[model samples]
Target: MKAASKKTAGTIALNDRREICNVPEPSTTRLNKRMAELGMCSRREADDWIARGWVRVDGQVAPMGLQVAADARIDVDPKARGQQQEQVTILLNKPIGYVSGQAEDGYQPAVVLVEERNHWRGDASKTRFAPQQLRGLAPAGRLDIDSIGLLVLTQDGRIARQLIGEDSGMEKEYLVRVTYGDVAADVQSAFPRAQLMRLRHGLSLDNQPLKPAQVDWQNPEQLRFVLTEGKKRQIRRMCEQVGLKVVGLKRIRIGRVLLGNLPVGQWRYLAPQERF
Candidate 1:
């Protein structure tokens, strides 16, 4: 049989019997993406929940790759919420010689310090340490192996997304000990004000403009840097560009969280009421 074509305007012919009127595309998004955008969980987490029948859309169990309207009511199963609550976030005072993520070139990763023995005695959080907490635990951000101070490791996807996501604007504060040329003492007096200004706003790295930073002399040989972005070896490279040689670097803060009194190579659980 020959299929019929639509001869009329504003209509599309599907077959010999059916004709459909033209309509605007519906505003919808993938369920996983929508869940991530809503900050419920990461896209990967959403996919896992959907696969386990733990997610519902409009009161129906959501299928993988399902498209949902922007206004759709999405609910996560209580089991999924329970799992999320069990996930932990760890803060470590990553000493020099440990990589932020994976072990490489004979260097141990920072997470190795999260064992029970290394747990900080000063940690006020009552959460007990368990071997299961190590499973899926990973670094949320990178700190150079030679650098020291606050390094966040987590099993929670939401905290990871909040700290290192593509659109994240979390501030990382560093105290850098530097020397100006042959002047290690009173180097701030020799450093140019214009160079300091460049460090604050006008510098570029990797062929891209750096976002304005809060850079100021903390002492004669130390500079305090607060930056919103973390390019690889960013602080060292920025100092090099301005003729400053970094001898030491320590991160003191990330967002509102501080690395206060945490001994080197020690780890602590992020307190329940504490947030990054």
Candidate 2:
């Protein structure tokens, strides 16, 4: 069962095409948080809907951030569903030198590469390019300006929450090329196995324990890492702890979706049938 279905009762919002499932039991938590827990929307989006009187509890408009009972029947206005339908998700093979969120110091943001001309010809999605698709679109998860690979940008709050929310469980896989300073020393031999163990389970960042990650050597100079959480330049920091320097990094997949041959600096739509 989904975590949100623990105690709450849910009904599809009127006129909604997709079932409004996953509404969480209120259980004394803030209303915005409850909506996010249910996978309804991100907390920020929930707050916006509540403020607009687009959210309801037991068929009545909900008050902003109100705390309520576990069994409250939460509902969203049809306008919310309409708004959701307009959202789009884009996948990009980000090349180095472009920031994920915004431009800085003369460097452009990766979204600038999401132009009509950059749409991959092999994309199976028949959705035509529209300037409106760029409106309100933001990076759901960030990739370092120095790294390259799959970078997700979207207007959908649900997709954003699914990938980067506080409680998200989606996995991101990356291939990294590393250097350990000594030209003749192999990283696997020079970097102690115990440190690898720490990379898998014992490491912490910002005074909090990092979620366990899958880290293993892909080749003599490359490592494969799969992580459930992202911190600022996390992999690079983790490598530093073990005396390894990350020379190159490329995200290969997010959840079940692979970046697969999407040329750098190009993008494609996230197909309707794909979930992550």
Q: Largest TM-score belongs to which candidate?
A: 1
Q: List model 2 lDDT by residue over 1-276, tens digit each.
A: 675664333433332434355455435878888888888987888988999999989888898769867677999999998988777899999999999987899999999999999999999998898999999889989999999999999988888988998888899999998888774347777777888898898888899899999999998778899999999999999988877889999999999999998999899999999988
* lDDT on C-alpha atoms for all candidate structures: 0.93, 0.88
Q: Candidate 2: deviation at residue 15, Å?
A: 45
Could you give candidate 1's per-residue lDDT for residues 1-276 as a string of tens digits?
123333442243333234245454578999999998889988888999999999999999999999999999999999999999999999999999999999999999999888999999999999999999999898999999999999999988888889999999999999999999899999899999999999999989999999999999999889999999999999999999999999999999999999999999999999999988
TM-score, one value per model: 0.92, 0.83
Model 2, C-alpha of 237: deviation from truth (Å): 1.1
Instruction: List RMSD in Å for every model shown.
Output: 3.6, 11.2
> Quick one: how many clashes does candidate 2 have?
1
Model 1: runs farther than 4 Å from truth?
A: 1-24
